[model samples]
Target: MTRSLHSTDRLPASARAGHWNAVIAEAYFPLDLTFRDAARFEGQLEHSNVGDISLSRLCTEAVQYERHRHHISSATEEQYLITIPRKSPVDFRQLGREVRCDPGGFILERGDEPYRFSYANANDLCVLKIAKPVLATKLRNPDRYCALVFNGREGIGSLFTTMAQQIQRHASSDPNSDAVLSRHLVELLALALDRTSEVEQGAGSSVRDAHRRRAENVILRDLSNPDLSPEIIADAVGISKRYLHELFAEVNCTVSQFVREERLKAARDLLQMPNPGQMSDIAYRFGFSDQAQFSRLFKAKFGQTPSGYRAQITAACND
Candidate 1:
C-alpha cells in the first residue's frame, strides 16, 4: 500500500528538524541535512513501492543534503534514483562530476556513492528509486550513468516524464494497477536511459565508444533475429567486422558474448514480470534457438534454471 509522511504544524518549529531529518532519511537515505529555515522547516513526502522500485514525491523548502562516505559505507543495498525537480534546479555533485539539473531534466544518482544534492529554494521533487539489479537488467554498466542529467522534455524522455507524473497522481487507486503502472514507468525509464546513453556515447570524444554503442544498440533492437551475427551488426553499425571485433575487445568481450549476455539479462527481466509467459516464448523472444539451449545458458550465467529462478522471485515479491 502507498503512504504519505508529512511534518505537521502541531509540532513547534524548534522541534521539527529532527523529525524532518528522520523522515527524509528513511524515505531516501541517511544524509546530513541543513534546512534553509531550520526554525520553520516545512516538508511533506509521499512514497510507495512499485514492484521492485520505490516511487516518491518530495516537497520541501530549501535544504542542503550531503551523503557522506560514512553513510555510503553503512548502506546495505545499492540503488539508483532518478530525481526530477518541479520548479528549481538541483546542484548534484558526485564522483568528480558536478551537475546542475533544472526542470525538464532528471539526474541519475547512485546510492552507493557519496554525493551532495542541494536546491536553493523550496522545491518539489519526483524520485524513482530502483534496485541495482533491477536497473542492471536494462543497462550494461549502470554506474556510468550516475551523476548525469538526461533530457526529460522530448521524445522518449517526454513520455517517461509524463508517465511518472501520471503514476504520482494515481498510484493508490488500485494496488494491482499501481504495480502494473510502476512496471510501465520503469520500462519507459529504461528506454529513455538506453537512448540517452547511445547519444552520449556517440557524442563523446572516443570514436571507439561511439561505434561500440551503435553496435550494441543494433544488437539490442534486433535481439530476436536468429540471423543476427557479427557481420550483420557490423554492417548495420557502419563499421567493418574487424573494427567491431577490435572495439569489443576493448571491453574484453566478443560480439557473440555480448549478444548472449544481453539476451540472458533480457530473459531474466522478463521472467521476473508478474505475467511472464511460457518459458519457450521468452527464450524465442531473446533469439534463443530453443528452450533447452536457453535454459542451459541461463543456468550457467545465473546459477539457476529459469523456472526455478522465477518461482523464487515470485514468492519473494509476494512475501
Candidate 2:
C-alpha cells in the first residue's frame, strides 16, 4: 500500500505542528518532534510497504526527533531504520554512539533503543524500516551496525541505495513480487554490511579485528566440512588455537557455538527456499552428522524444526 501526508494539507499553519507530530507518528513510531519554527514548519512524508518492510521518503524542515524510553517500552518488536540523507546531514545518537551522516552516506538507527535524530537544515531522506528478525536471518548481530555510516555511493551500498529509491518510486501492486523484492533488498543489505571493513571495529583492536575477520572467513568457507573445528580454523588463519578461542570469547561466543549458529542459519535459509531438497540432504550438506541433530539444533535456534519451518514458508507462499 502507498500513501502520503503533508503538513500543508487543509490544516491552519498554527495547527501544523501538532498535526505534523501525529503525521510522523503514524508514518513511523511515536516520537517527540521539535520543529525549529512550529507554526511555519513544513514536511511531507510518502510511505509504502513492500512485504513486511516499510519504505518512507521524508522531506521536512529543520527538526529533531527523539525516541524516549517510554516510546521503546511500548514497542511490540525491535526494528531498525536505515536512513539516507539527500539534501543535508543528519545527526543521530543512540546506543552511546553519535554520528553525523552527510549526503551520499547512510546511517542505521536501532528503533527499540532511545535515540535522538535531527538535522539543522531541511533535508530529503529515504528511510527503510525493517523488523529485527527479517534482517537477523541474513546478518548476525544487526545491532552492532547501528550509528555507523555506510557508503551509499559505491559497490553494494550503491546498489542497495539505488534499489531502495527505485522501490519507493515504483512500489509494486503485486504482493508476491513485493515479497521477492523485499528479500532481495535485505540480501543486498546483508552483503553490503558483510563487505564493509567498519564491521570489525567491534573487536577493539586492529590486529585482533583482522584476525577475527580472517577466522570468520575461513569458517564460512569451510562450513560444509563436519571436522571444521577451532584448531583447523586457527591453523588456516595462521593463528594459534588458544588465541582463536580467545578471539571468539571476546564476543561472548565460543568457536563451536559460532560455527553451530552459522550452520543453523544456513540451514534455515535453505528451508525458506521454494525447493530446499530433502531434509537429510540439507542437514548433511551443512555438515550436520544426522537429520535428528539438525532438527534439534534448528529448533533450539529458531524455535521451529526444519521441516516445520519449511512448511510454514510454503503455507505463506500459497496464501
Candidate 3:
C-alpha cells in the first residue's frame, strides 16, 4: 500500500494557515478572518489529500481572529465541526452562550449557524469535519444534534479523543488509508450525535433500553455466528422485526447495524490482547469467513486495516 506523509515543518508559511482555514470551512461554518497581527502568527498545518473527508492537526502562534455571520452564506450546507484544543485556550459564542474552551475541551460548531471564535497566544488543535448530509441521513433528527459541547476529559467525550488519536496515527502512516478511516470517523460522529440527542432530550427511560439490552446480550453470546441478525435476535426475544427496528429507532440505529458493530468491537478487543490469537483463528472465532473479510470489516468499523491494527497493538505491547 502506498502512503503519503505530511509534516507541518515541510509546508510554507502561507499554505499552512490556508490549509487549516480550508479544513475548517469544509467541516463547520465558514469564517471571515480579520487578522490583527498576521506577520506575528506562525504555525504549521498538515492535511491528507482525501477528498470530502480530510484529517489534519495544526499549531498556531499568537493571533486574533473573528468569525461572523457574513461568512455564512445562504447556499451553505449543514455539517458538524469538532475542535479539540491541544494547547492554550479559545473563546467562542453560540446562540448567545459564551464559552471558554480550556485545553482538551471540545468545541462543536454547526455549519448552518453563525458564530465567532477567537484564540490568544500559541495554540494547537485537532479538528474533525463531517459532512452534514451524511450525518443527517444517519440520525433520527439531525437538527437537534448541532452546536453541542462534549467534555473531552470524561464520558463519550473521551471516546472522541481516543478516536482522534487513532485516526491521527493511521493517517500519519498512510494517506490512502483515509477511505478506511472515514468509516470509523463516521461511526464516531454517529455515536456522538446519538449521545448529544439523548442529553438534550433530557433523561427518560432511554427509548428502547430493554430491547437494546436484550439485543446486546444476544450479540455477545453469539458473536461467533455470522448468521446472527436482527430478525433472528428479534425472534429469539419473541419480538417482531418491525418492533425491534422501532426500538433501535430511538438511538438512530438499526438492530442489524448494532449487532455488526458489537461483533467488530469484540474483534478489536481480541486483536489488542497480548499474544492475540492468529489472524485467521480470530476471524473464524468472530464469525468471519476468512482473514480477508475480517480485515475489511475491521477496517470499516475501526478505521484501520486489521493487519495495521494488530501491528499497532503488538508494537505497543513490545514497547
Candidate 4:
C-alpha cells in the first residue's frame, strides 16, 4: 500500500530539494519552506493513505517551514500532523505555544493554523497526517494538543510509538488491515495525550476524568433519546446537573456540543455500513428529532449529506 512519492535517488543531485518540495505538497498539505542548505538539500517522502489517514515517513535535511495565512486558506482538508521523529528533534510553534520534541517524543501540528515546524538537523520523521474530525472523535477539542510535546516513550505513548515504527517497517499491509490499525493508532494517541493533560491538571484530574467518562457512557447509551440533555445524562451518571456541565467545561466544551458531535460521528459510521438502514430511521436512532435536521447537520459537519457521504465513500472504496 506504500506509494513512493519522492526520492533523491531518482532525480539528479541538482533538483533534489525542488522535486522533494513538490512531492511533499502533493502528499501532505502545502507549506512554505526555507531550505537550510539549498544546494545540498535532499529528502525522501513516501506515504500511504489508509481510509482518510496518511502514514508518511520523510527523511530530510534541516529546513525552516511555515504554514502561514495563505497556505491555510488554500488548504482543502483540515489535519493534524502527529509527528514522531526518530533521528532528530523538532522545534514547533503554534497558537503562541513553542515546544521542542526530541526523539522518543511527539507533537501535534495543526494545518488549519499558522505555525512553524522545523528540524535543526537531518531527521527521519514518522508522521500520521490525520483528518481533524477523525482525531476529534477520539479526543475532545484536539486543537488544545497542538504545539505541546508528549513523551512517546512512556506508558500508552510507548505503545503508540512502537506501533508507528512497526507500521513503517512493514508498510505492505493490506488496505483493510491498515485502516483498522490506523484507527487504533489514533485512539492510543488520544489516550496518551488525555492522560498527560490530566496529570498536568493536578489534583482535580481523577474527578474530572471519572465524571467525563461516566457522562459520555450515559450519552452513548441514550443517544436515541431526542430528549437527552446534560441534566438527564447527569442524573443517569449519578452526578449533579451543574457538576456535569462544569466537567465538560473543563475541556472547553458544552455537554450539548459533545452530544451533537457524537451523533454526527455515529451517523457517519452507520452510513458507511453495508446496509445502513433507512435514512430516517438512522437519524431517529441517533437522537435527531427529524430527518431534515439530521441531513443538514451531517452535511455541515462532514461536507456531505448522509446519503451523499454513503454513496461517495462507497464508490471510492469500490474503486
Q: TM-score ranking from best to worst? A: 2, 1, 4, 3
Writing each residue's lDDT as its tens digit, candidate 3 over 1-319 gives: 1223333355565665665455445434457654545434455555443434555566666654445445544545555667788888887765434567888667666555556677876787777666777666667555443344556776667777777756654544454566666666666666765775455444223324655677678778998997887768876765455456766776788776777777788889888788787889888888887889888988888899978998988888789
Give the top-scoring candidate (lDDT): 2
Error of 4 at 67 (Å): 0.4
Task: Count clashes in each candidate, considering only residues at least 3 apart in sequence or on different chains.
Answer: 0, 0, 0, 0
Pick out the ten consecutive residues of candidate 4 with the lowest summed lDDT. Answer: 198-207
Ranking by lDDT: 2, 1, 4, 3
Local distance difference test, candidate 3: 0.64
**lDDT per residue as tens, model 2, 1-319:** 4556455566788899888888787878889989889878888888898987999999988999999867876788888899989999999986456778999988878787678999999999999999999999999877667777889999999999999988988867898998999999999988887776754445224556677889899988888999899879977876556557877987899999999999999889888887889999998999999999999999999999998899999999999
What RMSD does model 1 have?
18.7
Candidate 4: misplaced stretches above 4 Å? 198-319
Best by TM-score: 2
Clashing pairs in 3: none
Query: Which has the higher lDDT value, candidate number 2 or candidate number 4?
Result: 2
Which of 1 and 3 is ahead in lDDT?
A: 1
How far does residue 180 in candidate 2 sit from its true spot (Å)? 1.0
Worst 10 residues of 3 by lDDT: 1-10
- Least lDDT summed over 10 consecutive residues: which range in candidate 1? 199-208
Tens digit per residue, CA lDDT, model 4, 93-200: 764456789999988887877788899899999888888889999998776566677889889999998987777667665888877888888888889888766543
What is candidate 2's TM-score against the reference?
A: 0.64
